[model samples]
Target: MPEETPAGTPEGTSTARVGGTVDVGGLALTRVGFGAMQLERLEGDRDAAVALLRRAVELGVNHVDTAQFYGNGFVNEVIRDAFGDDDGVTVVSKVGATPDPGGRIPLRLAQRPEELRAGVEDNLRSLGLDRIPVVNLRRADSGPGLRAEGDQVVGLDDQLAVMTALRDEGKIGAIGLSAVSLETVRRALPVGVVCVQNSYSLVSRQDEELLRLCVEQGIAWVPFFPLGGSFPGLPKVTDTPEVLEAAKSLDVSPAQIGLAWLLHHTPNTILIPGTADPAHLEANVAVGSLRLDAATLRSLDAVESRTGDIVLD
Candidate 1:
């Protein structure tokens, strides 16, 4: 539980009744959550980013997904600045991708125990937390296992060993994996994986198998890009026939329909839609209220699954 604070967001945003809670390990997180990636787009405005994070908490958001690679570690700093004293907020951060000297993401994968240990330390320092509640070991496209062996990939056990050791040491509370396949999740079951974050959305169904696994195991499945991201070659939620039809019938925006579908799609699924705009943030949280009927859900299911072509950004 987070310590009581006197701060409050602007009027009319409403408390976090938008979505119910899902237990990520022992922490019951609101199904609708916030993502700090957009803080990078803020162009280093620490105050604006901090205010946004604090507002999310005021509106009942307890789960915040952040990463050290975001804004060159600026996003985690904003989270620490905004909720450093709030124990109620569960900050979920990721490791594996590191920024190079040119400030661009390198192809390097942090899989070794020592490398992962340093990544965990970086997250702890950036977030100013004694221990991050949930730390996801993101599987970069290079695949899991040691990076020293080129093109000869190893299994996740070696990496899970490092994460589990950190959990025992009290540096992290729960372990999760991002952009992993069903096989990886199965291999990680014994490691006590509590959650899985993937790029799943209305039009993105590449991780259907993994989502099903999480549902069966009662693990939290957080979809990073619930709304189709603006990246090129990705299918927009509004452009999808089923999503558009649902939006028109439901009298809500396409994005709202998309988010609502995700909430109804799986009980364990949690949303972390990132937005720098307060109005957009409020709208995202309010997506919990837009319910889709069975027919809409069926139509959505029938929509051709094009997620295979969409690459993770």
Candidate 2:
């Protein structure tokens, strides 16, 4: 069984028993959180993204996931600007990579221990927080020309050791891994992993096994791209016929149905669906109230993806 909460506290505040908790230090968090990737100036304007982050908290989202590479510090700034005074929020940021001088989307890896430390310090400076709730090691194979400037690439084990040291020093509350393989997750488990963030959706179930392991181990499983990638593809999760039908039955949008499926699928699954529009943010938060029955969930699970396997590690 999971650890029990002390008496007299609110149910979801500290324990989050309904949705399993991912321990950031000793803090337990709800599985459903917000991903702040979309808060940057992607297509043009950033007002929509700002509104979305603000509305997420208004709608009861406590966990906010971000990275130093996101918009070269734009996302973190937005988060800090939005909820700097709100003590109820838990802001999670990642290190291990930094944006190029010219400003880029995908970041260049800075795997050296010193570079990692600087990245964490930069995150603290940007988020305006003494210690972030969780810090993930953002691992990527491509984008930007920055490389690990050492004789060897920093392995997952080495990264975990760095994060563990930081955690012990109270610089970060918990440690997590992003865009890593199941093998990497297993390797880092002994170092104390609290959560895993991967690209998973109805159309992308490649991380199914990793999600299951997180549930069994009482770790939080946060999915990044819940709306598929940024392209027009076949109806995967949100655009599926079955999902649309279920949404129609529930009198909600397809996105809500998709998020509902994630929330109901497992107690550990957390959906961090990002959006620039405040309307979309409100819709995303409304998903928490939408429930999928067993039949609908089964139908959603039955829907298959035609795309190639999603490999983030």
Q: Identify the leading candidate in terms of TM-score.
A: 1
lDDT of each: 0.77, 0.70
On a 0 to 1 TM-score scale, where does candidate 1 land against the true structure? 0.87
lDDT of candidate model 1 versus the reference: 0.77
Q: How close is candidate 2 to the true structure, as a TM-score?
A: 0.81
RMSD, one per candidate, in order: 4.9, 5.1
Kindly state the number of residue pairs that clash in model 2.
0
lDDT of 1 by residue, 250-273 (tens): 788888888888888888888898
Show model 2 residue runs off by greater than 4 Å.
1-25, 42-52, 100-105, 141-152, 230-235, 309-313
Which lDDT tens digits does candidate 2 get at residues 250-298? 8988878877787777766667777776777766766655657889888
lDDT of 2 at 159: 71
Error of 2 at 252 (Å): 1.4
